[model samples]
Target: MDIDVNDSTPPAPEEYPDVDGEPPAWAEDRTPLGDAIPWFRKFQGGMHTKEGILYGLLISGDAGVRSYIDDEIIITRTGGSSERDAEGKLSQVADQKDDTAISRSVNNSMKFNIAVGVVIGKKNKILKRKLPHAFNVMDYFRVAYVWHERIDGFIAVRFRLEKLELEEKSWWAEKGSPAPPRTARRKWVKPIEHICGACAQTYYRIYMQGWMCLNTSCSQFWKLPDGNDPPVELDYDPKWLDWRHDPSDEVQPHYSLVPDFMSVIDDSDPNSTYSRTSWKNGIVCPSCKQCLSRRFWDGWRCDESCGFKRVLNMQTISLRAVVDDYEVAPIRRAIVFDPGPKETALIEPEIDDVYSHPYRRLVFDLPGAGTVTHFVTNREINAKPNGPNDLFIQLQQANLGLRRYPLSQAGMPYGFVVAVDSLPFSEACDPILRVMGRLTWATHEATDKQGVTALIPNELLALGYFEDMAINYHDDGEDTLGPTIASLSLGAMAHKSLRMKYKYYNGFTKGSKKLVHDDPVLEGCANRDWRLDLKQKLDNNELDWPAYEAEWWRTYKANKSGAAREAPPCIKTQLHHGDLVVMHGDGVQKYYEHQVELEKGGGAKLRYALTARHVLPAKIEPGQWPKGQFQLTKDQDYKGT
Candidate 1:
């Protein structure tokens, strides 16, 4: 959970004046007899009183509080008598248990800053108190009534404190062009009522380095109080020039990932459709950065004779499609990484987080998406152990809503479920997180663009592709989706293809076409609740694999067409095991759709992919979803109707 600090000022006497000097106006008659307790004042209050105290704390510039309850609270179980000072205030308790309930409550109240003592063997040799730097002395705890549980924990007295020489003043002063007269003085930055840049409406304490404007209607970009200059653009290497052309599988090589199966038609034969110049307009090699021209049969060859060859299974093209010849774009769109080899071990280690799953692998892909990064995390889970080496296999299974989604004319090639802020950092996940951040920054040196910075991944998709399962063409064009999507492929080698959406060349003809467009909003779709039936059938042993395939095919054929209308052939790329694919550029997700399919004749029976995205903030809240333990849907970032 993100940390939220209270920063407000107390109201004036007239605004919430003490009625007859008894209490603040709102607290006068309405104050319950139970509320007379002093300790509970820190936590329980209505809207007005809550703001009142928060404002008081901020105006006083106090960074923290040193709370002291009655000695009875700490020494009750030990039968110790309470003592008092000359002022009649309860003295600090002498008899205290480290493991008592009171100790736990205090520790959990805030994210405390601490100084560790030297460790002697398994225990600390000494301990010392390390207070916040903004702490200053004040007495606000004298107003509470000293009662036991009836008064919400007896508070004998408490002290408010401010840190000496607070350092944030200079920073706040720099935000204003000419520091305002009121702001010129260095005291405390209270909950200032300022107008939002987007809607010109007043907001309370909503300025920060990584916070968005509080205006819900405006949807303005995130900006800091002082302002920020857009990032610099990445300079392109001269060697990575544009080399795209028309695509066709007729002259491309065909290879099987499992077996050494490759075939090339003899161009010398008179009946051959392709000759020595067949691959003149082929794409570049994904393995090596060389252009793969169509000169040989089977697969295209690198012009420099790099010897990089593979089946023309899928053409690797830019994230955005090349509608015409005048387009100048990046030669390569996705990147493939190699992590050497896998280690053979018994019971593969899986690290647990707060979520239902664990970190199944060690590869991460972080892509710079203008201002923030879109990161990928790969995790694997299984019901049963594949072998003795699979230590992370789960005997207890939890469903994270992974299911197939329907596209315009085809379905997603694999099962996928999007996770919203679900993955938490742990010992196993932290290393990858750190590495990805550094790698993304390194990549920005060559790919950075103005007005863009690396952002954290907000959504995760756990995708599974069974044998013969495949996803069709679909662009992630949801308004909530970010400009980039990064994915890490694991398990089996799968064919990931990106196809250009069909738009008529003639404006007049476009108006007459009735092409099917998948609704971007996925709320209330059949896929949401439909997956439960499939899961139930599988669990109950009532599903027949052969019958399932036959039924799916029947539905596929009836989905308005055997295939989506052809505009142009698709560009393909191979996602080998442990490869990372970062689809950059805002135009990419806007103009193109992609699919993941099982490579024909591949050795592995299943493939898995972990794809990460930055969903819009409006859709991340769970309260907007259906009332249930789990909600599964095909829609990407769909807001409820």
Candidate 2:
């Protein structure tokens, strides 16, 4: 799997691709191949290692240490900071530190004869030539030598890498030309080796000026002969820079530089199991051979417009079988009722009342926040045809145009984005209408006792999760949203948990970076006695909020580092098919965030979370408003059953 130069270019566009479609902005500059292929992926540092084994080297000319490529050899420096003195200034080169993890990995690779892939950054000045790509993937090489060197008054590790294949022509050279033969180039001589009398360490005379005891532990380290002062800076000896290693038997790489992308999954076999972890990795486009990240929900599409796309055809599974598989699990024998250290309790009906009604209700009242209510439905509610099972299958086959969107400027887009009314408001199909109706009923039931009016949901977000897919902790407290939000769980069983906001638990301001107050006397948070004392002071009006905040900072600074600790979940429960979870009150989202994790190793391969929210019409833009009238007919309304 050598990447040919032509493979990077996209194919020519069709004569009339699309009347309204603009040409795709194919990326010309090279970018990090992040999990696009198995062999090579993006890494942070100059060296890439896995489990203490060096796998690749990123050579850049802009590093602090000198690095260069000459013929078939690469001379690069290791990574680490110099030792600082008591005054915080860097120490002499002899006192520099070279014991970094990357340096150790380089030494390990040299000792183990591990072949490492080489990538050349465009900014490299060693070759004094511009590269065709920002990051050019070179062939693999073996760590030929490892040594310690002094650079800018600091000790640094250096590696000498030699190309594994000696007979192949170097890609950087002129077309059809191999490296200049040793006999054809200028004559070169090897540098003299010096033995240190003080430390008994062998040293190479690589400096242009002279040689000294290179060992840092020796008294004569960096000392020139006859007390001759060493140059303020050092330069490599031209003869040493020109030195080359003798040709050896060709060594093969353990893996190809570009792994086969088509083998990621058997696309032809629709019945095969597809784990989220396996399919989440990017794929190499078969047409342009460019590495593409898995950005879209449906499939991989080449951004270069090479006319290559792969959409996975996942089959709809039975929700009944999924519930059956979950019940068989060992952990399902007893329901999880973790009250956490703060004693936030989980309340449920007695055994007699549990199965009496159309649905069983469970509730957890969060401290200083609103309630989280779960309506556990009966088996009749989850039956086939117009039930959760039918809804799950229909949603899977619907053309909702669901996809993932980037939450921030960097990193991969995570979690499926909201799929709003894709059709006219008056024309929404049964599946969407069913979820909205159920959520509406649940929201009203959960909030009516509190004298809070329920808001009819205008938007529904249908998110699909494969094996191990999950939604991280986030709040639904948006200005445009109503106080209550409800969701319907379908397919595989999922575990949902709610936790106090970090700022609320730690009493620290997230944006201002200040210790503003003591903990809010929550049940599960740390420092209970301190929080209680503060609460008492506030109750008595002996201290106001500002005064208490100042006192808290003073007291906390004396014993703490002002670091925030993660708050544990106060409410946790499992959500099965036909389960309705209603989070009522603005305080719930304001004080807490929730997350949902799908059950792994299940009978159903997919789970769908259809959440409905009341989107205020005043907040929507004029152009974004729905075209048709929005109204739910009598038949679309759902009762408690």
| Per-candidate count of clashing residue pairs (backbone under 3 Å) | 35, 3
Measured against the true structure, the TM-scores of the candidates, in listed sequence, are 0.26, 0.77
Error of 1 at 246 (Å): 63
Candidate with top lDDT is 2
Q: Which ten residues in a row have the lowest lDDT in candidate 2?
A: 406-415
TM-score winner among the candidates? 2
Q: What digit string (tens of lDDT, one per residue) describes model 1 on residues 1-641?
A: 24344468744423431111111101111121112222122222211122112111211111112221110111111111234457553343443432443333222221122111000010101111111112111112111111111011222212112211122221112122242223234343333345767677654432222333443345442334545421221111111111111122111111110111123333343222222122222333444332233333334544353566554332222211211113211122234343223321111112222221222121121122111122222222211222101211110022223333321010012123332223322211322332233223323321343344634454445555434557777766676665656665544456765534453111012445442222121111122233335435545668665654454334445543334343332344555443445665665565455677766542213444655555555544554222112222232111111
What local lDDT score does residue 52 receive in model 2, on the 0 to 100 scale?
72
Could you tell me the lDDT of residue 40 within candidate 1? Answer: 23
**Against the true structure, candidate 1 has what lDDT?**
0.31
lDDT for model 2, on a 0 to 1 scale? Answer: 0.64
Per-residue lDDT over 1-641 for candidate 2, one digit per residue giving the tens place of the 0 to 100 score: 12223335432322212211111111233332545534445445566777676787777644444566754678877654544457554333443344667777777777776788877766665654445555666677888767665666555666778776655556655334445554445354666788887788987776667777767667777777655646655566665665545545334455666666557565444324345644456666666656665555566777655778888775555555555553422321234454444345433322222432456677677656778888876566666357776787887776666554321110011122342234455556667777777888888887776688887666666677767778899888877777788889987789998888887777776768565343456665556567678778977899988897777777677667456677777777888877888888778888788999988774335677877777666765655456323566666677765
